[model samples]
Target: MTRIIQLSDPHIVPEGTLCYGVVDTGKALQQAVATINRNLPLWGKVDMVIVTGDITDFGTAEEYARFRSIMADLALPVRVVPGNHDLRENMRTAFQDQDWMPESGGINWSAEFSDFGLICLDTLVEGHHHGELQPDALAFLSDTLKNLGSKPVVVGMHHPPFNTGIIPMDINNLRDSAELSKIIESHPAEVRLVCGHVHRSVTRSFGKAIGLIAPGTSHTVTIDQRVENPHTLSLEPGAFMMHEWRDDGIVSHIIAGNYSDERHPFTTPV
Candidate 1:
């Protein structure tokens, strides 16, 4: 079994100010790092840790420095790809040592795991919140799957391929979704798509694949169940997801940034 953790949309900035006005993203991320190191085994035997992007709020050198400082002690094999707020050059400079992190123009890439396949897709357009995978990304998707033959695959990217009923946010972004959806739909039972950017845990079914939108580790966007204007962020606890791959199936747990309240049982003759 492979234990994989997904941290996304940290949006760490250079000056340590809240990326927006409401959340201290750096603090939240630091707490999460502590939580993982103290509890999650990903700090030791995690097969892979994938950061789905938006690592920096401004894509500055200092921002990456702050990010690195917060996650200094984590020694896991981590992989990262670009997001709307990330700059390829700056990321390359910051994480040069992590050869698994995709490099510029190497956007659409694939790597193998002990029992499955991982396809990292780049969905960032040069300067936009609305994201779309380019033609090259589509070709990469097709070719990568062809080579894998029958291994269960996971598609990783920063943007969710389909809008999640958030009209305001949806209207403003998440472009070219069907370009990749068609690919997944045709792949039979061989693929799953995981994405970040929604800042909330959401699940959707697309053809034969399950599409999962992981929560942000920095903060969460308000999930107005009514799905009205979706431009607001809430003080919701920071969170992330752990994908547990078992021999029979893969399950994802959306973990909120809080220690377990379930207490251990201890008994004594009193």
Candidate 2:
């Protein structure tokens, strides 16, 4: 079994800074790390931790520095992809030593594990919140999938390929989604697409694969579907995901951040 933890959209800032003069993104992320470490003993061996995107609120060098400091505690192999809120150059600079990362272009790359191959595609469109699948990104994905053959694969990105019903977010969702769907549909293997830009948990069917949207670690977006107003962020319980690949198939679980009064012994029912 290959166990993977998915932490996304922490939007971490410098140690003393607050995001938007409201959310203490740095503290939120710190709490999240504590939460994960607390639960690690229960989950057993976690192969790696994948940060889907939006790692920093401003995508600044200082923020990335803080990000590095916090993630270093995990002491596990860490893989990341850029989100709309991220700057490609700085992100590459922050993790340049990772031999798997591409030196140029969209930052698309792949990694191999005991039970699955991870194919991470870059959907970051630089100056926009919306994501794009340019020619180069698509080509890289197609080639990676073809090379991986029939192995169970998890395609990680920063944007969901389908609209999530949140009007403001949908406006900035992945563009040319059909083209991406076509590529995944043609693949001859069980593929699961996991991403994090939505800030809320959602599941959608993407052609022949399952697409999962992981919750943000800092905050969650309100799930309002009406198109008459701007979307809002909420202080709801932040969360992450755990993707467990067993011999049968892949099972993804949503893990709420911060553990306190929720703990209880698993005593069998009388």
Best by TM-score: 2
lDDT of 1: 0.78
Note the Cα lDDT for every prediction shown. Answer: 0.78, 0.87
TM-score of 2: 0.95
Deviating ranges (above 4 Å) for candidate 1: 41-44, 101-103, 225-230, 260-262, 266-270
Model 2 stretches with alpha carbons more than 4 Å out = 266-270
List TM-score per model, in order: 0.89, 0.95
Q: What digit string (tens of lDDT, one per residue) describes model 1 on residues 19-55?
A: 7866788888887777777775333466777888898
Error of 1 at 169 (Å): 2.1
Count steric clashes of candidate 1. Answer: 0
For candidate 1, give the lDDT of residue 98: 72
